[model samples]
Target: MTHAERAADFLLDEARTDWHDESLWQVRGKRDTIVHAIPEWEALRQLGSDIKDNVLSNLDTYLEQFERQATANGVTVHWAKDAAEHNRIVHSILARHRVNRIVKSKSMLTEECHLNQYLKQQGIEVIDTDLGERIIQLRKEPPSHIVMPAIHLKKEEIGQLFYEQLGTDEGASDPQYLTEAARQHLREKFLAAKAAITGVNFAVAETGGIVVCTNEGNADMGVHLAPVQIHCMGIEKVIPQAEHLGVFTRLLGRSATGQPITIYTSHHHRPKEGGEMHVVIVDNGRTEQLGREEFRNSLKCIRCGACMNTCPIYRRSGGHSYDHTIPGPIGSILSPGIDLKKHGDLAFASTLCGSCSDVCPVKIDIHDQLYKWRQMVSEEGLLPKTKTIPLAGAGTVLSHNGLYNIMGKAARVALSHAPRVLVYNGMNPWGKTRELPEVPKESFKEWYARTHKSKF
Candidate 1:
């Protein structure tokens, strides 16, 4: 099924859908409260955008500088041109250490690379240490949100998941109780793990360090406790200088979850004493995205997820509906660049409300890009004939004033007089979910002309 079909299925459970909508709306509300209080929020966003623009313009220079500094600080750096290379590099590191099990913190880059499945196929066990990540890991599901991995799930669902996996009390659903149980469970994994993998929120070129922001301190625990630490970052994660960190760090948490700042913003400049640290920089179609003039601005994303929260379509449709690693407005634009044929349907998943762009901490024109992708998809002939045929006909008619006026009158007459079965039939895809509007008897032009005849 296409993304729209999957999203339609998600809407079947009204109560669950309502719960999901309210949950994200609440996050958006919190972000508004905090962002409005900050008089410099817009300025920060503009600065963050400008910094990223500069970084992208000279990405090669910044990356080389970052690698030089990181290597000097006793960190090993690996570059991957694509996902396969990224997965191979990570596995090679694991094999070099002869480690079978590893603890991992929240890293969406890993998800994009399908690192967990690849490692598991090679006989490695990867344990997600974040609370939300662990919950979804047990459920064998991808995260619905970047920051809150299992936000789609409720306490009762979590209680059942923990009961089945961690042997927690069968009826316990309290947040504190579940968190403690998970903490104890993950602690054992952390201590026993010989290596750990984490995602980099920001990689500062000037200091040759990486920043990981987490609420649970999972990244720090996993990195510090393990003998080997692997940090995965997309090439776009690099910024020019250390001072730029101040702007992004301030915007990240407040925009994502409305917190003043992340509870723990750990900067790892070097590996632990006697431990090895590896940073894998993966392009995986990022350079291709960067080369696209219209879409390159999407690279500025800090992954704060504020756009996802404010997106009405995203809240109701659910993240999984996008059928991509990262789902929502941002994902809609980025995923198509990775595989136009496979993810072409994602571009049509938005209402073009522009709310996503309005709330972006880095001012990515998400909705505008989504619209642009639609044109690109259609131009590439990726859209199904069902849409293309009708759109082509509409385009032809709309280009001719006489045909346009004739079609408008005919449409109003048919909509107003057609029988229920005829107007709301199987052929009308839109009529399945929503009723056709009550068409007025007269066209707007006809009514206007009649009303203003004396004046004219």
Candidate 2:
């Protein structure tokens, strides 16, 4: 099994833990109730979706318009068509300013492109300022959650890590003291850093300003404090105006953490006094994804992370299990676009629950996209060859009644001799941790033929 598949297996194992699966299912239920209480929530979702759809449809125009406006505001705009180009642009900007150390705000885009590793290779020390991201960074692990990078880790684990890395006393495990210690440590990095890099939540076309949403105010602090600010954003992040950003910001927090709104929605129209600001708009396979009608709606994502929180698979498996920067339902669909063969199994990670679609701030039909990705993956011949036989057999069996009955009889006979572990090990990802059910001695057709069919 591939890393992605292995991650899914681990998550399935986690789900088998007593009632943990039901807890996430409960979260989905609560989310629905909360959203239903707001009369205009659906409308806002529709508006956000339509706005993003419009922006994507005319992306070329909006992108150029944003460039012009941002340039007029004294911001340098750079375009990168893929991950390599994006990393090169950021590295070049850092080199031009002679920046050796930099602080970063939470940015899934950077994670998506593995920016930290790239920057480290260029000899630039990059520190993640987001609390969760910082924890994962210290651990040298990818974030397991989009909103809460270290959600899977308990506070004791964090205390231990802090004790080891920051010279804190072994017993210093209080959330308050831990937060304060992190604050003090990151503050020093922020103050001494020559440059800061942030991910853009939304870039306004009308004013050419970048909008960032954060609860901790780290993004604002990093950008405003640094002598140089570099903002990396996906091409899909552009919106028509600041007013348009309001719609997304409103829905973003509610969906992400069940908050009314994030504490700060910082808009960077200009760099601080004597500082230079640059924005790198990265394609990274997003443009090609936009042209794909079935999957294009995936681009409307606002990264609120509500879907991941509500997803049963994501909660148990955590973000790292997805083996991608952005994990869970959204990552399943997005990863294949970046690397078709290696990441193909990601598409099969979903249970088609549709809760992700329901909680999406911009209303991307994530479940549909996952289904579409599976088909696309199969069409591209990326699925494992060994599994092809059973998949093909399933298709044939389902298509013909005669074959279905014959297969049903053969399955019963096979189950009689098959070890019970084979049921646990075959066809189900859940078998990684849980025992599979025994096949019935007779099919439903067999039962009906002997009893009810006699009357007919």
Candidate 3:
């Protein structure tokens, strides 16, 4: 099914859809409130954008520099060209360590690579230690949102999930009680974990350190306890210098959750004593995306999720509708770059209102990129018949001024005098939610000529 069909499934539950919309909009409001108080928010965004530009422009030099410095710091760095190699590298390390069970913090890169499923097939019991991740993991569902994986689920649903899986009291939906239940449930997994995996928020070339940001500090716990630790980082996550880190850090929290900073921004310089620390830098498709001129700016994403929080379509449709690891406006652009034929429909799932671009921490031109992708989709003949047929007619009418005017006149006549059934029917999705203003009898050009000719 296309994005619209999947989104229709989400919209079937009007109550849930409205609640979901309000929940994310509340986060967006919180983000606006916190950011308004900051004196240098825009400046910080510009600085972060500049730093990312520099990093993307010279990513190779920085990667080699990072590897050298990291190796010097007693950290082992491995490179993977894509998801298969990435999963293989991770599984090989686990097999070498004889790890039967492993714990992981919230890692979207791993989700993109489907690492948990791969590990499970290899008979490794993967436990997600982050509370939201653990909820979805137990339920055997993919993350709906990048930061809030279980945001699509309600507390009552979680209560039932915990009741079934964690043995919490039936129908106990209180937030604190459920949190305590999760804490007790994950503690054992953390203590027994043989290896821990985390996603990198930023990797610094100057100091050869990787930083993991989280509100729950699950990544810190898993890394500190496990003897074998792996930090899975996308190649685009690298930065040029340690100083460039602060700019992103400043923008991340306020834009993400209205906080001064994430609760735990842990830095990993080296492994724990007698433990193995592996930094797996995987390219999956970053180089391919970077080579594309129109979409490369998306690499600047800090994963703060501010754009997702503010996006109207994402708020109402839910992230799962996008059918990608990272969802919302940023994902709409990035997903298509990876497989335009498969994800082409996502490029049209927006209002092109630029709200997402406004809230992005690193200032990615998200909506513009979505529009570009839409054009690319049309160029590639990727649209379905429903859209392709109408757009073909629209193109002809819009290209010539005379044809556009005649079509406009015809539309006015139809909308004005046609039967109600003709105007409101199965084909017009736009009329489902709202109606247009009354059709005018005269065109703007005609009105201009008649009204202003004598006076002006």
lDDT of 1 by residue, 1-456 (tens): 899899989999989999999999999999999999999889999998889999999999999999999999999999999999999999999999999999999999999999999999999999999999999999999998888879899999999999999899998999999999999998899999999999999999998999999998999999999989999999999998989899999999999999999999999998889999999999999999999999999999899989889889999999999988888889999899988999989999889999999999888989899999999998898989899899999999989999999999988887777788997787888998897677788888899999999998
Over 4 Å off, model 3: none
- Order of models, best TM-score first: 3, 1, 2
Which one wins on TM-score? 3
lDDT of 1 at 308: 88
- Scanning candidate 1 in windows of ten residues, the lowest lDDT window is 435-444
Compared with the true structure, the alpha-carbon lDDT of candidate 3 equals: 0.93
Tens digits of lDDT, candidate 2, 1-456: 565556646655653432444555564565566677789998998999999889989999999999999999999999999888999999998898888999999998898788999999989999999999999899998887777777777688899999999877797789999999999999999999999999998999999999888989898888888989999999999999778877888788778766677899888897678989999999988888988888888898888777887776676665666777888898888888878787788888778989888788888889988988888888888888776887997898899999899988998888788776676565666786665477787888888888896599
TM-score for candidate 1: 0.96
Better of 2 and 3 by lDDT: 3
**How many Å off is the CA of 125 in candidate 1?**
1.3
lDDT of residue 162 for candidate 1: 91
- Inter-residue clash pairs, candidate 2: 144-319
